[model samples]
Target: MRLMPDEHQVRSLDHQWQLGNTRGQMRTWGRGQFRWTTFDLSVERGPDGKRRIKKTTLTDTADLKNPLRDAVLAMGWSWRARLSKL
Candidate 1:
């Protein structure tokens, strides 16, 4: 999947916030309006203790809201804190 140029920071398992990569496809429809849909967030941690994400071809079919809630419960962080307009 092709992701947007920018990424939004999200809290992960570590309790510290980090960038979450969004994966989706750009679609053109209805009077040339383009939109990205069915996007999902992914967060990863590197050896240096900084979080990073790598692109993956597979997209999880599960609902994102549940996982976001789980993150909040597990890490005690608000998902809305760093959310963007997208």
Candidate 2:
């Protein structure tokens, strides 16, 4: 499936892509004191013959900082951290 974003968003994405920030690395964003992980963008040709985001696949570093666990804890869940968990 193809994903579309507005021109402003596309410009931001293009800027990131051009800077090589989205290359072989998982993007991170800060939420309060926690850093959250995000997927890498994959591009593909759309039906209209235009390039678009095909999918967002999670990177192998999902567990690097335990973002998922932090999210669960933030939601007041009784969770335990496991080794190499995603």
Candidate 3:
């Protein structure tokens, strides 16, 4: 795996991702289509003193790119919205 950084971590998320374990296939649901997929993420602490997510879930497994960015962004923004009050 290549070393990289999470803007939130001030640390590298590349370690969270690896070339290995790229074989765990699961399921993917999109636009009424469900298919096999895999998980490729892990949760860890970031420099922000909060849970920093380095994709914290499956990325790409079936040699296809993970296609949940918009949904993830929605949740991310929602999380931030909740945190904004604190």
Poorest 10 consecutive residues of model 2 by lDDT? 7-16
Kindly indicate the candidate among 1 and 3 with the higher lDDT: 1
TM-score of each: 0.22, 0.27, 0.22
Q: Look at candidate 1 and tell me the lDDT of residue 5.
A: 28
Model 1: per-residue Cα lDDT over 21-66, one tens digit each = 4653453223211222344457888899999876654544235446
Model 3 residue runs over 4 Å out of place are 1-35, 56-86
Worst 10 residues of 1 by lDDT: 27-36
lDDT by residue (16-84, candidate 2, tens digit) is 121225464655432122224467778899889999986675654446535654654575553433222
Model 1: colliding residue pairs? none
Candidate order by lDDT, decreasing, is 1, 2, 3
TM-score of 1: 0.22
lDDT of 1 at 57: 45
- Compute the lDDT of residue 26 as modeled in candidate 2: 59
